[model samples]
Target: MNDLVVQTDGLTKRYGERLAVDSVSMTVRRGEVYGFLGPNGAGKTTTLRMMLGLIRPSAGTVSVLGRPAGRPDVITRVGALVEGPGFFPYLSGRDNLRTMARYRNLGDHAVDAALARVDLTDRAGDRFKAYSLGMKQRLGVASALLGDPELIVLDEPTNGLDPAGMADMRALVVSLARGGQTVLLSSHLLTEVQEICDRVGVINGGRLLREARVDELRGEATLRVRAAPEEAAIAVAMRVAGENSVRRTPLGLELDLSADAAPALVRDLVAAGVDVHEVSPTERSLEEVFFEMTAEAPTTKEKVA
Candidate 1:
């Protein structure tokens, strides 16, 4: 069996003369949090819709849990909260979950447990209209977790959440993945995605730009070392990292060289008699990696703003 819970090949979706999603190929591994990252209107929501069969792709294919997508049984092994999950404002949170379960034919099993998972157990009986935006969102998430399906697709799950609410949602997502559920989570929050996602597929202009595991990315090494006496250290950094690779950093001259070249770097530094204070890997955050991997041109709006 394929290790991927969700796979799309050359997934294309166009609206009239406009292309919303263009030949987007992405995968979500069976037990990993795969972040579908892009800016607003970069086709993230459209992509999720296609995966959930809410919208069909104009071209290409989608598969979920070894079964073909767009099939009647596709939803059987999937639970998704697309965009903001729409629910009846009149119904109580518990009633809403019950309705969803009944519609999905799950028949009253662990409804309260799902509610408790989202920290909505006490408010389960509160009318949806009376619930705050965060509370309603939590309820929607609770509904999605009802079936405990193998795959869950969430689009901008933390969109309206405040700081504490965002923290709560983050924990909930991590818990879902830990429970052996594959998540195709779409978010524009690079920092948060970097923290939680095992792998990420970055999108720009409706196309997949990069796919990398966190470890694979972390393995792309650079070193940050401080030299007690500055000039000798700079010269050593230049030799080890090459003249173009050395940069003056806040601490000292930074070496943008492979981690494997550390011995040569240290030897050069030692020969120069530069007191090396700390030699460690420079951890590049996902946002920095995203900037490096994408196009150089700034957004039109960024220029305007």
Candidate 2:
């Protein structure tokens, strides 16, 4: 049996003369959170649509749980929230969940269980239209969980959430993964993705630039040093690490060197009579890496057919 719960091979989507998703391939292993990251209009939604069998790919294939995409059995094992949650505004949250459960041939007990999982049992009786945006998002998640699916695909799940709501969603995702469900999360929020995803695929201009573990894609560690005699400190850093290895930051000088190199660098700065106040190694955030990767990607003109 394949270890991967989701796999896409050369998935491509074209709208007339325009290529919306170009040869995108990705994999999501069982019991992991795989982030699909890209800016708005960078084919994230398009790719997701194809994965959920909402739209057919122009080329390539998608397999879910070892079965081809769009197969009824395979789809039943997957739950997804693409675009946003849609339900009858007049209906109560519980009624909406019940309605969805009926459509999926699920029992009323499934609705209750899903609501409890999302901590919405208390508010499940409220009208969908009266629920806050965060509440609605949670309802969407609850609906997805109604089938007790093995794989969950969420696109920008936290888009309308406030900070607290975002935090709650993150915690819920982590909890789900810990409970052994595989999750495919698509979003442009780098920090959120970095925090939750075990691995991430960076996409831009309808093309996937790279896919790597979160730690691997974080890039290199840099030394952040605050010292007096800024000019002297910079010179010393450049001499020790090389001219291209040093740069100025608002707090101090940042050296493009590993944490292991920090000791030698500090000694060199101190010996040079530079009053070093602090020296610490800092890991590059996902945002920095995202910008670096996307900026280096070949520019393309927007085309629509």
Clash statistics: count for each candidate = 0, 0
Best by lDDT: 2
Q: lDDT tens string, model 1, 212-256?
A: 896676556678887768878877777667799888877666678
Candidate 1 at 266: error in angstroms? 7.8
Candidate 2's C-alpha lDDT?
Answer: 0.89
Over the stretch 175-288, how does candidate 2's per-residue lDDT look in tens digits? Answer: 999998988998888899999999999988999899999989997788899998999999999998899988998988998888898888888988999999999999989999
Question: What lDDT, from 0 to 1, does candidate 1 have?
Answer: 0.80
- Worst ten in a row by lDDT for model 2: 296-305
Candidate 2 TM-score, true structure as reference: 0.89
List TM-score per model, in order.
Answer: 0.86, 0.89
Q: After superposition, how far is residue 192 of candidate 1 from its true place, in Å?
A: 1.2
Clash list (residue pairs), candidate 2: none
Poorly placed runs, candidate 1 (over 4 Å): 217-219, 226-229, 238-245, 248-251, 257-281, 294-305
- Candidate 1 has its poorest 10 consecutive residues by lDDT at 296-305
